[model samples]
Target chain A: MLATAAAAIALIFLQQAPAEDIDWDAEFGVEERERDPATGEFPVDPYEKSNANAGAEPFANGRLAAAFGGREGIRRIAERTVELSEADPRIAEIFVAHDTVRLKRTLSEQFCYLLGAGCDYTGRDMRATHDGLGIRTADLNALVENLQQAMREAGVPFAAQNRLLSKLAPMSGDVVER
Target chain B: MRTPCVATGLMLAILSAQPAHADDLEWFEGGKLVLTNGVTTIEGTSGGGIATWATIAGLEMDNGVGVSGHATIIELPDYGWQSHGVAVGIANRVELSYARQNFDTRDVGTALGLGEGYVLNQDIFAAKLRLLGDVVYGDPLLPQVSLGVEYKRSLDGDVAAAVGAARAEGLDYTLSATKLFLSRSVLVNATARLTEANQNGLLGFGSAAGAGHSLQFEGSLGYQLSRRAVIGAEVRTKPDNLGLGEDDWFDLFAAYAVTDNITVTAAYVDLGSIATFEDQRGAFLSAQVAF
Candidate 1:
């Protein structure tokens, strides 16, 4: 009698097992899961999708490219940075040897690359270059202002500029020492 | 005439040596750098069959560099007495410390008779490097974390190891996270110490025969009472090695800035001792002057 009862219990347990667990793909349609969200409307994970820079140049698309005006826009901003930097020796000293103008030029180019604009930055490592300089908060704020001005002069739209700025905001802490 | 000339020359030298102060300037502007001329004392109990007492005195600079000498006196009724000491700093994100401890078994009396006599004196040298975290920076939301390691070497060999010491020389590591909540006017500092040393290597080392590691937690909360005054309370723990007592300590501390160049601190401490001996608690005060 006990053995018969045990057999009945096993049968009930087997029946209770979820069929969906046995056939997951059948329950959730595989093809329907992969479609991108509709255009003119943001995705649920907009930041994740926008920041989905999988390789060497991470900021190449979406907002950053528009901010730098694609290739021509980035080049124009770089040129202006060099002109302004040359006018101010203190600014010039912020960059390394032979990099006085190149560094400024690369800022816009780098923004373009990050915005998915298909450009390469190829700049020096951030931390090693800035260590021990005691860069003050005011110094960084000034640099950001100058870059913003150059962007405005180049006619990069305001919204695009903001999007790119947001990406760089978190790095302020690791860069500022004093 | 010669004596008068010499006196005048001496006066000129003294005047030149004094630090210049801009009399025309207001008391504080352009962010005054207040020098600390004050004493800070740790409040912890002391004394027992296994007793421990530690104190540090010196100046903590505005740039976060502190120089102070520390001394500790411990007593083991059956084993006799032991004392350790050192001087150290917290600057350039680096800490360097040196200490020496003596162990003497008084009961052996005249037999070991080398003078109060056949005691073991161990010299310890320690250095720590801060890998991350700044005590001065950060918003109220983010806690600052600083990772550091301390390497302590004991000079007296067999004598130090005889008491089941941690090692003739061993490295102690610690990580501290501190946050200053400006809006609340409170500072919270927490520390996790990893070590095998008994009483922080004060009594030579830990009793563990093999590699041993113990985790200790310390927390301090300070309130800024005014621009130049702060008061705080701290609780810290230690390991019980002599098998004689519980491990706990606490203190209430206060600091006052006397001038731009001086600060003072004081504290009441309670440090529990081994077994059931009297609590080793006392009052301490210190003064600091920075240039």
Candidate 2:
């Protein structure tokens, strides 16, 4: 009986010893404590870099509503050119008188540029074109109205349109007559 | 074990067949609530040839079942105001409606000896079917076309018929096409109707068959100012059924979506009424709620 009791006690002790006598330091790993440069404080935060922050939180591209003047906006502008020319007799006459291919191509380029659409514009200057055609302000205004109406019909909301038209308005002085 | 496997497979096949049968009915697998606001002229024949800009609320669901309610009100100077008795959409394809209109003839009261108190009211029952148009998804340019008919009866049948009647009651039928240009944020509508009804809802004039097969043409342009707001203008040619006038009028309308379930539409209407009658230039407002 005495031997059996000793044997049981030894078994319990062995099981308990394995768990309780763990090397905690080895498990956690050794980390060096560094002093702050200014205060010379020990145990400085490992993540601390500097206080300055600029710009915005970084985000992956194409994850948000795309920036304005993208390919879609530019394509709309190009399509508008065709629609505008077709709807107004005056604009049609201009196309008939001028080089149709060049005019169509150049107008497309100009629309992309005005929309800030991600496309290159290779066309004649606006002032030169207007001077060549003697495009009056009234005619230009009519074209603008036609464009606005078509865009409205296409369901391009007014706010986005207004933003794009504002950039194109400055060129009106050069294209239109006083 | 073999028998159990076959039974399970049979049950699955039966369940799948049910949905396949339903798919043939509608383009969208899940039914959706589609909102359509078209002018209320009550199918092509009626005594009162005039119509108001009315809105229709529609509920369409998976089994191709649809329901809708239409309402409109127009206030006239010589004639009193009128309102739709309302209608129900039976399926995603058919709609039935009733409307009542009262023309006060307030200014012409002394002339008719009705003490400027003459009011003409008629009840109209109408039904419409979705013919070829589709309320498309993922598509920005599909028209919603519907063909409809309306039967109208003047409460004072005797008085209405005496004014040179063709059909003691009236019948009107029309075809409407509506499209929303998503990229441009505008809605365009075109409608043509054949009818003989005089003032559309007024009972005084009879059908126009005696006069001619009067053709009515209408066009509308609407702009979506915001996600829930639309402003638009409409031009409609109406028949002069009352002998009181010749050419009808045009109107400009504005509508706001108060919530997903309700919409409020207001318009400035100008209907050239009877000879020297008050220019039907007045305001119209209607609120619609849908489930």
Candidate 3:
């Protein structure tokens, strides 16, 4: 009887185990593509899905784009983000010497591109852009705070904000150096 | 007069240096990090009241340091127990803790002819090293694992011996694993301990009926209600070597983080029997401050 009870308990534990091998990016709504069976690598750029609808009509089918009020709403979020970053003491130093207008425009373009707005991102890749600045995890966290505040101030729904954040979170690998 | 003046100068220098050292440390914001990282346990470990988890205390972002202090009170029907402790986490990788416990025998003492309010005091010093995996982010198949050892010393050796205890103190070694399932908003922990502590060392180590070390198990499950609160239940099995009809312990608790530096926990505990007193049910409350 004791052995049977132990086996039942072990079976229950096994049943509750998570399917850990699933790709998180795909699970979070990233577009799926074919992968090489040998190398388990995709041939196309992984980030292309985020930019698939770029240069297309805003909110045509994307839930995140519609929730953020489309292209114009994304632009507003970018502007507010830049403003907040400049005012945030923890990260203000990083923006002190940046060109405010250029930065805002790049940010607007990036948001629009990510949201499938009819715009193309012309900025450099995340790693190259952040290289040599010695950015740490704390600095990244501070920037995320500013971004969240900016999104909230711009009336972006919380769900939409989280969706966008999920897409951007993977960039930390390329951005943070310290 | 000259010696007094020099002593005052030295004291002033030490006082001034303390704040300078504190200022050099970084403080992370509250709520920005994941839940379940900073709460303090009754044993001064970074876990729930009755269970010692594999995580460390404080909100150290990456390579930062954090320190915390906790005080817990458990009011049983026939006894009262209080514990005061402090723990330090170094870069979220290692933890060092110290706790002092006082168990009030109250009416039970009178029944045993040891006075009406006899108190049993013990000191515990512990260190835990995180071995592998991250409870929150690492591979879901593998939970965070840690190894720890707690050295306990009873202050009342004579009284402990009177109760047929073999030794006044002993060491408890533990292997703990903790996992957080973010999708389900639940956390689970399991720990295996090798010890011979009777009534958590308040009654000393081992007894006439049962001597030497025995293996025990502890399990805990918690559900996150919000960014700052978690409701959990814990079960800790004890060795029955004392011939005192010792029973396993259970508790249901809620731990809330009011801020990055302050947390409060309350629980309903059923300690079963202590010193042969039956049905020891009571309330448990703990407050912790960390940074």
Candidate 4:
């Protein structure tokens, strides 16, 4: 009886022993994400991507794009805007823990698409992306100021800068929660 | 989830450990774009030198308080005018202002039998409330609008009576709308005023002839030259109750923000006539500081 009980206990311990140290994440069915090698952005859940996600129609004329220095200039401006916002104390709290790697890429795409620089936007819509972010009007304004500063540094003409602002200004409705 | 809970506890501990005065002086928050506060006018309101705009006088955004002060001088041919004023804006919603205007009758005073250096002074107190829309946001077609009331008291009542002004003190009402066309970099403003004051109350209110009040129109159009500069024109029509040839006023102005807290405006103004002084055109200069 003692030998049979020992064998039974030994079999149960062997079956229960973890093969590796412990993947509590795997045990709880947690999703793991790795950054893309090229883009350096973590993977997000699948969603439909369309040009409508760009939020506004592209400029019919390429004059503004030319003034903005085309796709390269626009991408730089967008990334710089995100960088400045991350550094700005007034709005740092909103960006600190956020996925800025994805932000840089998506923002560049959106700006390039909207400025008529010949790029298709593949990001989610503004409302969907900003949902639950708890952003306020003041925070949005801070972001705009940072964007303006970036454009200024890029030598975008003030009026041309406003041309892009006109398109984004209306989107405050979706982005600002309070 | 455990990590988040631990992070929350750490945040709570740090927040409680912060000094008591860490966030006390937060009322003077400034979040509006540059020059969006508008330049303070001679009347202690945000406007284009002579006309009132719907924008409140402040460097503040919502839930913040701001204050502005201005001193202005309009060097007319026969008379000199100077005004010093201060205004307070509450959360971009309401504004309260006080201005003291001094009309130095230079030679005009002597012509009217008063001393050459005599000054006609008036105190103006005003309050305004924003009614709808925003100056810089929301629908592009919708403009910011406001309603305001002003009470003016003339210090030289006897002299005002001599100039045919019936009352020494009176009330004025104003409704204004202003908009900034961001894409085009243009600004437009219009104001309708109901008043019985003569010369904006420097000559007092109404007249024995009894046209107590009349609707007046004030308009301004501006082009943004840069983030820190704007060029504008204004037309403000006034009542001729005193009949001293108090014709309409017109000006072309350039406003420049020297810094975030300081703005200076220079203009060439045309006051058709004042106290029978015809061809009263001259330079208008003003400096304002806001925070």
Residue pairs with backbone atoms closer than 3 Å in model 4 (clashes): none
TM-score of chain B of 4: 0.91
Error of 1 at A148 (Å): 33
Ranking by DockQ: 4, 3, 2, 1
Q: Mind giving the per-residue lDDT tens digits that candidate 1 earns over B137-253?
A: 433355545555555555555645555565666556666666545435565777787766554554455665554677877767777665467788878787766454646877777
Candidate 3 falls in which docking quality class?
incorrect
The TM-scores, one per candidate, come to 0.44, 0.53, 0.68, 0.88
Across A1-178, the per-residue lDDT of candidate 1 in tens digits comes to: 5676799999998885565556566557653323234422212222222222322336533555655767787777766766665565434555433344445554655566666777655444445436676665434544555565777788776555545544554455656775
**Candidate 3 per-residue lDDT over residues B218-240, each given as its tens digit:** 89999877556789999999987
**C-alpha lDDT values of all predictions:** 0.50, 0.54, 0.77, 0.88
Could you say which candidate leads in DockQ? 4
Q: Candidate 4 at B122: error in angstroms?
A: 1.1
Put down candidate 3 lDDT per residue, A19-138, tens digits, no spaces: 879888877988766656764534433443334322222334456677777888888888888898899886788877665665676678877777666677755566655768767665
- Residue range A1-178, candidate 4, lDDT tens digits: 5676799999998885567778899889998778899988888889999999888998877779988888888888999999999999988988877789899889988888888888889899999999988786667778888998999999999999888888888787788785
The C-alpha RMSD of each candidate to the native structure, in angstroms, is 28.5, 19.8, 20.4, 8.8
Error of 4 at A154 (Å): 1.3
B213-271: candidate 2 lDDT, tens digit per residue? 46787777877676457778877786766565645667777777576456667888787
Off by over 4 Å in 2: A1-178, B1-57, B61-71, B135-142, B204-209, B275-278
Model 3 CA deviation exceeding 4 Å by range: A1-86, A94-135, A139-176, B1-36, B138-142, B208-210
Give residue B184's lDDT in candidate 3 (0 to 100).
60
Model 2's CAPRI class is incorrect
